[model samples]
Target: MAISAKLVKELREKTGAGMMDCKKALEACDGDIEASFDWLREKGIAKSAKKADRIAAEGLSAFAINGNVAAMVEVNSETDFVAKNAEFVALVNTVCEAVAANNPADLEAAKAIEVDGKTLETTIAEASGKIGEKLSLRRIKTFTKDDNEVFGAYSHMGGKMVSIVKLADATEEKAKDIAMHVAAINPKYISQDEIPQAEKDREDAVQTEIMANDPKLANKPEKVLEGIKRGKLNKVFSEWCLLDQEFIKTPKETVAKYLGNSKVLEIARFQVGEGIEKKEENFAEEVAAQMKQ
Candidate 1:
C-alpha cells in the first residue's frame, strides 16, 4: 500500500519525528497510522536510550495551579541552552498540568497518565530523542488547600527559582508576598516548631563545642554559656526559619509579625539544577575561538 503525504504528516505531527523518518515508518508499518506511531516510538526509544547515560543537570522548574490544587515540576535537560528552549518550556508546563489535573503520587504513576493517547513515559522518551538530550522528570509536588485558603506562586530567573505559598485566613495579596519571601529566603522551616528534635540536638552539641574552644567563654558560668548558646541558636532560626526572619518588604517586622492574624499553612520551593554538577563549558569562548579559526 502507498503511504500518502497525509499519513506522513499525521505521523510527524503525532511523534515530532523527521518527515523522512515518518514516511519510512509509515511504509514499514504498511500504511497503518497507529502502527507507524508505535514503530517510530520504538525506534525513538532505542535512540533516546543511547543518550540516557548523559547527565541532564539543567532544565526548568515550574508549576501549574487549578483552583485549590497546584502542581510543581522539575524537568532536566543536558544543557542550559536546551533548558531555555521554547519547546522544552512547553513540555515542562504540560507535565505540570498533568500533575495538577491528576495528582499523581510519583513519577511512575505520572508516566502512566496519558496525554493525547501517548503515556507520559513514552512522551518523555520521545522528547529525549526529539530534542537530542537526556531529559528527566526529577520531581513533582502537589499542593492542595481548602477553599478558605489562598495560594501564591512565584518563579524567578525563568524557572531557576519557584515557590508556592499557602495561607490560611490570608488574602491573595498576602500569599503573594509570602510566596516571594519563600523564594528569597529559601526557608528550611516555616516555623521553629517544624525543626526536627534531632537536628536541634545536633546544633546544640556543635554550639557547645564552639563555646569550649573559646578561652574567655569557656570559663564563664554554665548559665552564661547556656545563654550564649541559646542566643546563637536563635540566630540560626532567624536565618533559616521563615517566620523568624524579618520580612523582606518590611524590615522592621518579622514574617510572623507581618502576618498579624493570618497563618501560613505551607510553603514549597524548587530551584532548577540546585545540587546538580553542571558541566563547565564556556560556549561563548568556544564560539569565539571557532570564529578566529
Candidate 2:
C-alpha cells in the first residue's frame, strides 16, 4: 500500500516522533494510521523504559507568595539542559502560582485547578506535546498564616530546590534571611512536636541499643542508663527540629534564640521534585543502540 503525506503527518502529530520515523511506521502498517500509532506507542514505551533508571536531580523550584500565603515547589526534568528551558520554567511557575492561589492538598487537585482558559493538567499535556519531552508537576506545598508574620521563600541551585519559612512576627528582612537559611540548612520539621512519634520511638530504640553495648553499663545503674537515653533522645530531637537547629545566619545562637522578640516559627516545607521520576538516558547505551540501527 502507498503511504500518503497526510497519514505520516497525523502519526507525527500524535506521537511526537520524527517525521521520517512516522512515515516509516505508516508505510510498515500499510497506511493504517491507528496501527501506526500503536506501533509508535510500543516503540516509545520500550525506548522510554531503557532510560527510566537514571536519576533526575535537575529541574525548577518555583515560588508563589500572596500576602500571608505562599506556595513553593520543585519540578524536575531528566537534565540540567531542560532546567534552562524557558517553557519548562514557565510551566513550573504557573503550577506554583496555582498551588498558592488554590491551596490544593495534592497533585491531583492542583492539576484540576484552572489557569487562563485551561486546567493545569491540560497545560502540562500541551507542553509535553510541544516539548517532545516528559514534563511533570512534581510537588506542591502551601503555607498560610493568619497573623502579622511574613512568609519567606528562596530557590537554590537555579531552582532545583526551594525552601519557605513562615515567621509569626518576622520583619521583611528577617523573613528573607530565614528563607535563605531554610534553603541552605533544610530542617526536617518546624518544631519538635511536628516530629512523628514513630520517629521518636525509633531514635529511643537506637539509644537503648547503644547503652546496652557499653561494657561499663554492666556495672552502671538503670537510672544512669535512663539519663543517658534521655540525653541521646534530646540530641536526635534537636538535630531534626527547626527551632533547635543552629541558625544558619548566626551560628552563635540556636534558631529559637536568634530571632528573640519575633517569636519565629518556621512553618516551612521544602520539596524537590516529589513524585516526578525522570527517565534516565545512558549515552553509551544510546550510542550502542544507534550503532545497531
TM-score of every prediction relative to native:
0.82, 0.74
Q: Report the number of the highest-TM-score candidate.
A: 1
- Expressed as tens digits, the lDDT of each residue in 37-156 for candidate 2 is 777565552233233345656678888987667888776666678779998888888888888888888877887788996567556655654555555566777888886778877777
Stretches of model 1 off by over 4 angstroms after superposition: 1-43, 279-293
| Predicted candidate 1 versus true structure: per-residue lDDT over 67-156, tens digit per residue | 789988899999989998999999998888988898887877887778987667667777887988988888888889999999989999
Error of 2 at 141 (Å): 1.3
Best by lDDT: 1
lDDT of each: 0.86, 0.74
Off by over 4 Å in 2: 1-57, 216-218, 274-293
In angstroms, give how far residue 186 of model 1 lies from its true place. Answer: 0.5
Q: Which 10-residue span in candidate 2 carries the lowest summed lDDT?
A: 45-54
